[model samples]
Target: MKNTIFIALILLAGILTSCGSVKYFGIETFTPAEITFPETVETVVIVNNAVPQPKKPGYKYTIMGVEQDTTHMVADSALYDACKALGEAIADQPFFKDVRLYNDAVRQDEFFFQDTKLTPDQVETICDESGAEAIISLDRLLFNMEKDVFPFGEVMAGTIKVQATAVLRAYMPGRNNSMATIYLTDSLFWSEGASNLRTLDSYLPKPEVALRETAAYLTSGAYRNFVPHWEQAQRWYYTNSGTRWKQASAFAAKEKWEEALTIWQSIYEAQTNKKSKAEAAANIAVGYEMVGKFNEALDWAKKSLALFKEQTSDEKDSNVALLTLYEQVITSRIQANNKLNMQFGKE
Candidate 1:
C-alpha cells in the first residue's frame, strides 16, 4: 500500500506567536533515504560479522582524564546490539516484505582488519538459508570511551562520551560487489553538574549501559538509507489582529484547512496593504500544505516571499525571513516527494 501522504498539524502551547502575529504549528514531513534500492529486493536479512571487544590488554579507556582498568567497559554485546537495532529499524518500514536477523557472528576472528568482504558464494548461501533477497552485514563495530570531570567554583561537572563507528554492506545473491556500503560514525554524550562529585557520578549511565546505547546509535542511522522516514518540522501562519484572521486561525486550529483557506483567499482578495496580503498568502500556502497540495503550497509561498520583500524593501525583515524559511521547507518536501516516489516504485 502507498504510504499516506498528508501533513499532520500539531498545535504548540505556551509560546504560540512569533514576529508579533505569526503563529507556528508542527507538521510531519517524510524524508527520503540516502540510498534507493531496487524494488526487486523486497526481503532483507541482517547479519552480524563483527568481532567482540577482547578481554586482553592493549585497549585503554580514558575516564575523568585518567586511564582506568575497567571491566565494565568491555563491549561483549556491542555487535549483538548493533545488529539487533539494524534489524528492528528495517522491520519498522513497510517497504520490505520480510526481515530476518542472523544471530551468530559470521566473522568472529576478524577484529583488527576492516577490508574484509563476503564472497558471492557466502552471500548466496546466507540468502538461501534465510529466505531473503539481500543481506545487510554489520561488518565492523568499534568504540572509544572518554570521560572528563572539572570543578567550577563549588560545583562539580562531568561528561561521559562514547564514540562509535560501524561499517555495513548490502549484497545480493549474484552480485560480485556490494549493492551499498554504509560506513558511519556517531557519538553519544552525557553531561551533568552537581553540588558534589558523588551526585555527578550518579547522573551518568553505567559503562555497560553506555556501551550498548552507543552501539545501537551507531547502526540505527543506517536504516534511513533503506527506507523513507517521517520527521517533525515547524511551519508558521500569520494571525495578525482581525476578526477574519482570528476566525481562519480558529478553523485551522481545528484542522479545517479548506474553511481556513476560504477565509484567507477572501482576505487576500480584499486587503489593500501588501503586508496583510502577504500574511494571507502565507496562511493559504500552509493550508495547501495541510491538504497535501505541495505544488500549490510552493507557488503561494513564493508569492508571499515576493510580497514581503516588496513591503519591507529589505530581505532581512522578520516577515521576509519567515516566508523564506517556509519556501525552503516546501521546496525540500517537493524534492523528498520525488525520491519517495522512486523508493516506492512509483517512478
Candidate 2:
C-alpha cells in the first residue's frame, strides 16, 4: 500500500510540472488620443465665457433639534479654475507652441443660461489679442448640490454631493464652424458621521469648494483628447524549471532586455520541446517590443501563437490565452504608433 501511494504522488508531481506557470510584468505603452487635432492648432487660448449663477434661495434644515438656514450657488472662482486647469494641462504638451488663459469673463448677460456658441467675430478677436491660433471657450458651466442627513444606528450621518457640467467649444480664426464641441460632467461626494448632525455638517466639504474641485477634475482629463498619452499595461511570460529560462527572466527583471533577448534566442534555437520553444519566442517578442522594433515584435508574437496552438491540446492553456492577448496588443500598438507619428508631425 505504501509503494502504491508513493507512485501516485510521483505521477501527481509530474502532471503539475508539465502544466507550467506564468509570471506577469508591467509595461507602459503609448496610446492614441480620443480625438486628434489639425496641425494648424499649435497655439490655444482658454477663455471664461460662462455667466455666474445668482444667489440661491435659502433652505432650512434641522440639526439635533435646532433649525438652520443655508444658501448655495455656483461661484465665479469655479469657472476660472476650470479654464485655468485646462490651459495648464494643454501647455504641458510640447506640441502646443503657446497656451494662454483669458481670465476675464466674456459673457455677463446670459440671464436665461442658454447654450450659446461663440460668434466668429468673438473667436477671431480672442485669437488675435492672445496671439493664439485657436480659441477654447468655456461656453457654460452649471452646478447643483444635494445634502442629506439621516440616522445611522446611533450617530447622525450627513452626506453632501455636488455635480458640475461644463460645455466647451474650440474654434479656428478663419473657420465658420467650430472645430470641436465637448460636454463633460463630474461629481464629488463627502460623507461623515458624528454624535450630532451639526458636527457631521461641519465635517463635509463646503458647496463652493466642492463645485470648484469637481469642475477642475472634469477639465484636467480633457487634454488627452488632443494628444497621445502613456498608459500602463500588463504582459505575461512563461516560467518553468529550466535554468536558462530562469536566467533570462532575471535579466528581464533588471530591465536588461538586450541581454535577456540573447539568452531567449539561444534557448529558442536549441529547445526541442514545442511548448518550451513557444515560450522562448513569446519572451523574445516582448524583448523586441521593449527595444522599439514593433514590426519584428509582431512577427515573433505570431510565431509564438502558431507554436502554442500546435502543442496545446486543451485549447484553454494559460500560455495560449496569454499569447493571444499579447498578439492583439502588439497589433494595436502598431496602429497607435502610426497615429502618434502623425500627431507629432512626423512622416
Candidate 3:
C-alpha cells in the first residue's frame, strides 16, 4: 500500500475551538519527494562526494589577522562525520538491505561542497562500486562565518555569525525522471567580551569550534527528511455543559481518558432533552477522537447534528448555529485523521 502526506498538517495543529478540554496527536512535519523506485530497490549507498581536506603538517592559522589556534581545516572531516550519521540513521530504518557509508578516494581537485549534481559517469561508478540499487550523494556541505571585533574603552567585544547549507540528492536506476533533492540550512549567532589584547583576540569561538557547533546543529535534525517522522500535535475537545460534563472535563484534564469517556457516554445516553443529548453526543465524539477512534467520532458527530435539529423543532434554539459548526469541525477532523493514519499508522 502507498500513503500520501502533506506538510500542512503541522500548521493546522494550532487551529482550535475553545469549547472543551484538549488532546494530542502525532503527525508528519514535511512532505517527502515521490519515491517511485522499482520493487527490487532494496539497497542504497549513502556516499560523500565531499573531498577530505585533512590538515597538512604544521599548517598555520589566524583570527582577525592575528595568528590564533583555530584550525577548522583540521576539523574538515565534519562532513564525513555527518555522512556517517546519515548512514547510521538509514541503517536503522530496516527498509534497505545494505549500505556503504564512504568512498576512500583522496579527491584533492574538486570543490565538492558546491557541486549539487554528479555527472552521469560519477553516479554509475558509485553504484557499480557499492552494488546498491540507489545512491544518496552529498551534493554540497559548506559553512561561512562572519567575525566582527570592536574595541571599547578598556575592553573589546566580538560577534560571530555562522551560516551553513547542506544539499543532498538521491539517484536511482530507472528511466529518466526528476530526482529528489533535500536541502537543509541553518544559522547561528554568538558574542563575547574581552578586556585585554589576548582575550580580545580570542573573544569568540575558534573556527573549528564554531564549525563543529554549526554542524551539530545542522545535522541534528537533517536526517529526518529522508524518512518518515512523527511530531507531537495539539487538539481541543469540548467539555463545557453541566455538572457531569464538567466532571468529565476534569477527568480528561487528569489524563483519565477512559473515565472521561465513560461519563460522557452516560450523559449522552441518559439525557432525555434533545439539547442536552446533542451536547453530550458532541462531547462523546470528542472523546472518541481523543483515543484516535476517528470513525466513531465522526458517527457520533452526525448523531449530534440529528439531535440538534430535533432540539430546535420549534426553531427557537439559538444554539443551532453552534451545533452546526461543531458538526463541521468533527467532519474535518475525520478527514484529517484518515490522512494522518495512512501516513503514520500501520498498514
* Among all candidates shown, the one with the greatest TM-score: 2
Higher-TM-score candidate among 2 and 3? 2
182-215, model 2: which lDDT tens digit per residue? Answer: 8988887788999885687688777678778878
Candidates in order, TM-scores: namely: 0.81, 0.83, 0.63
Q: Candidate 3 lDDT (Cα, whole model)?
A: 0.62
- Per residue, candidate 3 scores C-alpha lDDT tens digits across 33-97 of 13434446667787776553344322344345565555434446567766776777767655567
Order of candidates by TM-score, top first? 2, 1, 3
What TM-score does model 1 achieve against the real structure? 0.81
- As a whole number from 0 to 100, the lDDT of residue 123 in candidate 2 is 86
- Model 1 Cα lDDT, one tens digit per residue, 141-232: 77777767777678888777888887888888888898888898998998888988788879877776888999998888688877788776
| lDDT by candidate, in order shown | 0.79, 0.77, 0.62
Better of 1 and 2 by TM-score: 2
Model 1 spans with C-alpha error above 4 angstroms: 1-19, 56-73, 111-115, 147-160, 189-209
For candidate 1, list the clashing residue pairs, or say none.
none
Show where candidate 3 strays beyond 4 Å: 1-43, 50-75, 88-100, 105-114, 119-121, 152-154, 175-178, 200-203, 241-243, 250-259, 266-286, 297-347
Looking at model 3, residue 235 earns an lDDT score of 36
